[model samples]
Target: MPAEGVELTPSPQILTKTEILRLANLFLSSGVTKIRLTGGEPTVRKDIEDICLELSNLKGLRTLSMTTNGIALTRKLPRLKDCGLTSLNISVDTLVPAKFEFMTKRRGHEKVMNSINAAIDLGFNPVKVNCVVMRGFNDDGICDFVELTRDKPIDIRFIEFMPFDGNVWNVKKLVPYSEMLDTVMKQFPSLKRDQDHPTDTAKNFTIDGHEGRVSFITSMTEHFCAGCNRLRLLADGNFKVCLFGPSELAVSMAEYGSGSCLLLD
Candidate 1:
């Protein structure tokens, strides 16, 4: 979050490649089928491609995807794709460059735009665009985002503003799923509906005459927390069982694949 005080960690404590692979193999062997690499920005990791290749080699691993800001994504996409990167979920709030700069407080909208096109150009299947919908902010650009999906196989996903720390969140900024759907439906009245997956966070629909999909994430207005086994790994080698929660529990990769897990189930 830009509003939060951003600082570079000095001598950061993160798991190495061997440890990461160990953890991955452990989880995969224990019924973890899918994996998506996310971060403050996973692209910042110089060894990301190496990490992708090692994990992709696992026979039990079904898919490998990533959520990135797309600012530095173009040059890395082809290599990552070749190494078992199945799909991409790029964050793009608005099509307008000026507004984008305003929201992200960065000067890389053009680069991000090119990155999106690059993913599509490189034949990335179903490229996802994660747009955080904030009312009186980037909400007006909803139709513009939908327009991109007309010719491309992109999935424009509208995520409601979540109450994360340092994000200056408020109920007024929450863009409900119903309202998001209504806004898009006004422009695209005839869209094909997609069946919901058991663990899908997005409510998906496709433009009737277009080649892509659109989805809305309504976590704020609706609760989907029960029985969700979402265990997130933080940047500094900690496990956050619930991402919105304040506390983080320590988890070590040292004993990850030693068959000594607490849950014997």
Candidate 2:
């Protein structure tokens, strides 16, 4: 779950607290144990803390988390933690300031780094960093990113760049999974795979005696089309069943009169 397109529509209408609560209840009734809130940037939402608090009180939801770009966590993390946010996944493409600017089209490397530090200080244990590996771009920064958190508790994951939003995707721009592992292994001889979280997207591995871990997501090079159990709801209320598929289900809130119409049995 990534929060990158939460504010797609002009003056987007955020799902109200009542609607969020109802949706949580519906999922719980269906025996779903985990729920993640994602957006183009979830922390940008005005009442994010309120939504987290409401979802935390749900009966059967055992885990609650969010995926953000780490731009606004400095001010919102404490409140989110108090409301039962146990884990966080932050997106970071490159450590080099210039490359980062080119990748995200934003000049906030310092701000993002500050946010990561603030989240760790605020007790976001086991914080994870997501880096999308693009060939001929930030692929050189893989070792630097791994070294930054090698002795810390952070989990750094290398994601193979994929085509989304109909962007032009090319194999030449993709750094394969084998190449990514080779790059890391050349520097850290003690790294080994961690088998605890088997279903995770990235293949989990750790520096033998260190607290930090590294992973690789082979979405394009190797597809995990099966065993993917997830759903995406756009800010405009369109439900996307597959991130790569063309199928879409659009539910008009105006027709249903409220958020209750989104309930799934």
| Best-performing candidate as measured by lDDT | 1
- The lDDT values for all models are 0.80, 0.74
Q: Which RMSD values do the candidates have, in order? A: 3.9, 4.9
RMSD of 2: 4.9
Give candidate 2 regions above 4 Å deviation: 1-7, 10-14, 196-198, 251-265
Q: What is the TM-score of each candidate against the true structure?
A: 0.91, 0.87
lDDT of candidate 1? 0.80
TM-score of 2: 0.87
Compose the digit string of candidate 2's lDDT tens values, residues 103-203: 77678888888877777787776788889898888898899988967567778889988877544578798899999999999999888887844345568
